[model samples]
Target: MDGTSSPGLARSLFLLLVVLLSSSVAFIEPCDLLYDQAVQAFYKGDYGGVVRSMEGALHSYAQVRRSKVGCRLRCEDQHPFDDDDAAAAAVAELRFFDVVLRRSACMNGCIEDKLGTQSMHRVSEDVVQDFHRRIPYNYLQLAYQKLKQPDKAAAAAHTYFQANPEHVEMGQNLEQYKDLQGVQEDHFVDREARPHQHSFSAGVRLYDQGDYEGAIVLFEEALEEYYKADVECRALCQGPQRFEGHNHLLYRYSLHELISVFRCTSLGFLENLVKRERCLSRKRWGCPSQTASEASGMDMFGRPFHLHGRLCREAGGFVVKAAWYLRRHKQELELLLIGSATMGVEFSEGQYWSSTGGREDSNRIPSGTDGWMEYVPISEKKNVSVMSPPQLREGGPLVYDSVRLVQNSIALNGTQRVLLDAVISEEECSDLKHLAHTVTMAGDGYRGKMSPHTPNERFEGATVLKTLQYGYEGRVPLRSARLFYDVSERARRIIESYFLLNSTLHFSYTHLVCRTAITGQQDHRNDLSHPIHADNCLLDPEANECWKEPPAYTYRDYSALLYLNGDFEGGEFIFTEMDAKTVTASVKPKCGRMVGFSSGGENPHGVKAVTGGQRCAVALWFTLNPLFRELERLQADEVIQALDSQAQSQWDHGLHINPKDEL
Candidate 1:
């Protein structure tokens, strides 16, 4: 009985142990076991294990595929699949990617059954057609096969021919298919893989295909070849001007066409002349045509002239020529001035004819806190200096070649007058005499030639009006733009000293000249040889103290007209003012002497028309500046602050500023 009882206990114990192990196994899951085992084998250099584990995962996946379908799958924390179904498809697709990625022919049919009727190539094609455009040739070849396009398959195989030229075997196989037309196309494509050539013929082909722009590029290449030859053959004695001229002309024309083609380019095109320098070489390297260079030195209407700078106490008393580089493309330069700059408040308040603070109907607008347009009434005290006549010698007309600013002055009113006198010197006098001769020669030569606008009678375009009218007044429009020069240092020094003496005085300044002959009959309707206008009218009446209040009055600033030589006949400084009705003031031409007064509508002044020979004079004007550069600096600061705040906000949001931001 005891032995039988012990046997029953043992059976029960054994059964209990089996039940416990079975429960543990059920909880662990066969898939989990396979996963762990496969991971371990994979790391131990058992690629077969990796395949087996991956297969086990798929097998487990298949068992409960319905439950896992359309569920998001994560790698780290990124969701590669947009949908659960996409996740499953990606898993299956990855296996095919892996096989083709390795370029393994060994695994050819391993996935055939699993892939079923959906070919691996079809899967690859779908991926590439959607988002994976950078597909491999091996995968693409397989895709062509599944598409049953033998010609495309052969074309794909031929892609590898460069590295593996022995692909003739594959090509022959593809030829067995009846798409002979496709095969022929592939052959033709292969032939075009030769080295390319750059020439006129090549460019002509491109041009014939409606590619004029491309043709231009080819022409440029041919031009470059010529340039290289010219460089190689450059002689030491010969100047490089010829070659440079050719190059500049070609480049200029090409750039012009390109600008028209795109219909857009930066201000760089206009500023090219400023940045480029003339270089000498047999090759037309940094070159320009003689005609173009000569043209640049002339005024807008193709008349020779020189740029000058001026300044005055009254408004419009000063007018400086725009920078030489900037003068050519005034429209573009104006855009820069208008778009970004904050103009003085007074400018917007009045029309072109009225001064900023003038009590005219056109300038009665009220001042605003912000905006480009605003009206600032001029204070009575501001016009105190305008009434006094500048003590300047009304000497013979003198001309100068160059001028530049140096140190400013800080003196009383009398001292300021003395400072202006200190600017003149013997050297300046001699320069005037030489300039007079040069002008005479140039005028003689120009007059001899058939004058383009000979009978300057009609009011044609602005060009015609300015050339004929202004020319008759003995005033030459500017030619090349003027820059800073040490020769005019004395004059600039005097102006600077005046400014220092009166910190309240702020204005722009420039120096100019009237050259050679004058054609009075052709300049204006009146028989008068010279016409003059006051310069003071540009100022606001309320702001200027020179003008009388209540009924309103006009003010005249300082203008210094110095005679360089006394070799001419009818050149005289004429001042026209409506003091006692209309008054005409005239001064004879004399070397070393200068006539000083106001200009424009404020004091209408002109040169008595040149009756004979040549006339040379150094003309300078000064104008007022209300707010000055200080205001400009303040505005710049405000713009910077706004930009900073915007930058901080972008930083907090973890985003970078756009490249296009106004950096």
Candidate 2:
């Protein structure tokens, strides 16, 4: 089909026609041979030979008839020109034929034949744009680096900030250079050192050689040795837990880098050993020890603290809920909160609780727990619906009785002073007092150990019913009520108010205020897909026995857990949902950072086991009242009626109508 075919076909046809017409002498096949030779010569760049052969064939053809070929081949039937003339004329004609046209056709044919071996050289712009939108932040950054366009790289970084504004440094840097052109050279420092920098190089080598389990053991031994050395160094410097006389930043940076390697590896035991190193360093650096007296006090970083009172949910009169934060405010809390989730804290009594505990009797609202009992319908949408659980009698860990106990215990020296022995700034004292009374009634479980009256009365630890984890029972009188006053009263009000205004539902609350050393893992039940739900929902399905008064039915509205103190570290919340969507929101152990969210099939939350420190908190759950129940029943009835009526109408029409006539 292409122009590369031989000219011999034309010559042969011409010669044959000549033989048939005049019975020409010799009936020479020389024309065919000459044409074949011309093609061979052409391959060898013999343009002259090709022209001669083509001209001879044309002249021979012109002497004969034009019957064999198509109409274009009907040339003059006479050999009017000599071979030389014919050759010149043929060559001129070929040259006049559009070379570009022939080349275009040939190019297409070549492309088709090579398609199987070729890669598509280009992608449409739309595809690239789509990738930019959905790709992960780290991947997008690498992509921009490859593109070598500083502006685009900066823009991608900005997009990352928009999505995760909690990354303070990254966000601030991005905002400073919104119109990115050239970046400052020192903006980023590659602080990631070679892994061997750590004194535990031998352990790292063992890990690299596929001895992960063994490496962990050796790493712990090295960590112990390092701690002993650091302690001696502290003694030489002055005392334990002080950073001095050296490049403090570099020292801190190196420590952080070393810790990061263990954290990244997810080798929990090795990480624990590294934390021991941190503890020694802290003592040497003069970091104040978080004593029982200090943690129980009301002052936070020497400031009079006031949480957003409006953004909480109230239960048993005590406000109980998590604090919701916009992106900007995450930083103020991050250092306090995120640091706690990182550093493992221990109980003053030498015991430490794991991060997460098993699901417990969620159906029953613990005594002193107070949360939303009424669901305020905000908006109505054709495709969306919201409802809360029915209201029931307030029982378990009674709030009113607990509040009275707290009020009687705290003796105020002056009207200005709220509670006796309560170390707080003037501003904080004022805020605490206001929050207490504003919360008409506040109640929560006493911070103590839990025990059954009889051996049989307690569900065997194996029983699923026994799985709910509560704080330890039996506490010192002086500290217990004081701790409760802040958490159950002051903190509770803020959480309750916040939820009523912003959150949709929060029905279950479980607060653990650590007064004694807590050590050992609490049972865990991830029976539901996103197994770790917040303390809002109770595990017991027998609703009647769990609540002070039965709900008349079963339902939970919402729940929250609030960290009241951030003296120690290493307690992060873990949540997993269907579709393998796992989210771990780290709660900084700060005075007032609250974690508030929905709990149900849609959102299940849990706290990651604490590694190094004692964790304390105030938890609250919300239940729907009469209004919540009435609305839900009404909606369900409507849907059922509508479906039934539609079915009946269809049947009636089918019996009476004729299909053809109806159409």
Candidate 3:
């Protein structure tokens, strides 16, 4: 009876807290409300209150994960994946981006639904960090200990210890639990852990028992949950930083307006290059760096960055906290790689209402974007009016005021150099789209071969060579082929100028590709049309690293996509972290909008599933090495020139050449 009443008490306390802090953080997660209840209960000697509140808090996580409440990303307004040989072979694959966005949107929507306000999606650092790090276990173990439930207390302690094995205090507590009565070895593990552990362990057992179907189901759960857990960690990493004295500093200032303004005390600078190397966030990506004295200004890529020298607060102090959750994901990967059932299960959020997330106050730029969220929106990036080449090319498109491609995000010396522009005219876009339909062949990207991804849909592509060949054979319009070649060359010149290369960028590969959703394959579709990947490296999913050699187009240094039309839906291009789990930035497809970026692991990207009409684009790649330039491009141009000459000569001769007589 007491156990049930505690949840009611928590809901009451949660309502009261909301009324009190409503004016503060407009958005608060659902689990956070229960978590707040647990914190209140702990302070008032209500140990049972803590257990009830935390349990409720943990279960409430299902709200963000479940699809019933519009938590999953909606592709309902569009068509579904095509039911092809590839789509029929397997179930739809959910990727890192789909899970991350779905979960983030769910959390946001859940908060908004509960509070009836729009403030929740921007979760405070305390809430994001606390929940994922299993901080509730910290309170739960102590609450259980005081409640005299040694078995439960030992389990909670073990869970927290696994997340933070370096903490001496937790280590000592575990040592004491060994001698505690009623605390068995089986009791020293998280029983209500994330769903994957049980499913995976059960699958291993079933596999050994030769229950193949049951084993398959369990393995699927493990795989899906592994995808979900990785998102939970990456989301937490995006929130604000609260170091040792953040709250105290808040108290030191009394003015309400000044309340939002506070700086981090210079807590020593970190010179650890080795540590940063292990981190997904690094400054050495192709972005140009500036020293402290340098003023904030725009670069050629059009990214605005301000250098703070030694004056800024270091994230290392607070950032390392995220590594704990990242390690959990790594362990899950290890669990899958080894396919072992013996792995341990574990996992577990609040705040003084820090003002770091607010715009016009103390804040940090979001990773993978240029000035977004206090953000620099893609719509506002029209600064570079010209090619701005480092050196003049004698025959380059001299003035491109109306045809420039703008960099979507700042480089910050990072791998991202994504540029967005609408250089093609509406007529040209229509022409290219028409040409794609004219020359498209069976199969999609693989060209009549089996899709490496799903069997549901098709990927169709025509290279410049194929387009030219088809046009000469009188199968497609000759003008459309010229249009395709012209657009690709324009993309190549834009890429060459934007990166400010000392030498010219040669065309390595240019393709016109289209992806379509099969009518009726739309149900249960949440996967990307093109899975997240780096252009120049082979992604080893188990290792979480992109190997930069061999079969990959190692010579290709840059990539660009020239969208012919935006008549479709749900096909946005996004730049992501190496894991392809967290989206750093996203660009919607539009007529004539070409997004270009480096073709390496420094800039991982993918296409969202096109749920509406067919999505078509001209994909282009450039290489610094001239030897590897598209030799076939030269042949295609030569053939087109020959056709032009033959037509002109026939017209000049005033005679048809069907008799096989030339001259």
Provide the overall lDDT of each model, using Cα atoms, as 2-decimal numbers: 0.34, 0.32, 0.57
Estimate the TM-score for candidate 1: 0.25
Q: Which consecutive 10 residues in model 1 have the weakest lDDT in total? A: 311-320
What does candidate 3's lDDT look like per residue over 1-663, in tens digits? 111122123223333433343323333357777887898899998999999998777766544433222212122112234435355343334443444455566556544554445443334444655776678888998999999998888888777655544333455676777777777767766544555545555555666676655654555454345334433333333332332222322222222112111111001111111132122122322222332112234243223244232222122211222223233434544544343223221111112122221122122211111110122222222222123622322223413567763453463124436555667889999988999998876564462443444554567888787787676667788888888988888788777776666788888888898887777776778888889988887765566666653436677888889898888768888888877888887888888888877787778888888777888889988888876787557556556556678789989888655666653
Between prediction 1 and prediction 3, which has the larger TM-score? 3
Candidate 2 segments exceeding 4 Å error? 1-486, 500-512, 515-531, 534-554, 567-569, 579-581, 626-663
Give the lDDT ranking, best first.
Answer: 3, 1, 2
Measured against the true structure, the TM-scores of the candidates, in listed sequence, are: 0.25, 0.21, 0.38
Instruction: Select the stronger candidate by lDDT from 1 and 2.
Output: 1
lDDT of 2 by residue, 1-663 (tens): 111122233344544443354433223233334444554555566655555554454343333212112111222122122344446877746544534345434433432332221123122232233222322332334344445555544544544433333333344445444435575433321111122223344455565576655554455455434333322222222211211112322332333333332222212222333333223323323333432112223233222123222211011001000011111123433443444455431111111212111112222111111111111122221112235542322112222222211111013111100111112233443343332222212111221113111111111111000111010112222223233334433433433443343333322333333321224432342222113532322333332112111111234554455544555434555444432235523334455445544334344454444433444444544444422332222222233344357679999987996778877
TM-score, prediction 2? 0.21
Q: How far is candidate 1 from the true structure (C-alpha RMSD, Å)?
A: 40.7
lDDT per residue (tens digit) for residues 1-663 in model 1: 111122123323433433343322211123434544554565575645544553454344333221111111111012222243445776757754653434322222222222222231221112222121112233334445555565555544444322222223333443343344545542312211211122433544565576655654554443333222222122111111211122323332332233232222222321221121111110122233232224235456333332111211110110011122234335433443453344322221112112211123332221111111111223322344357854433222223333322211212111122112324455656654443333323222121222212222111111111222232234442121111122233343344343332433222333334343435543343323344434554323333312322111122234455566668766666554434124354567665455444343345555555655655555444434442222212222233333357569888776655868857
Clashes of each: 49, 81, 28
- lDDT of model number 1: 0.34
In model 3, the runs with Cα more than 4 Å from the true position are 1-399, 411-416, 444-447, 540-544, 644-663
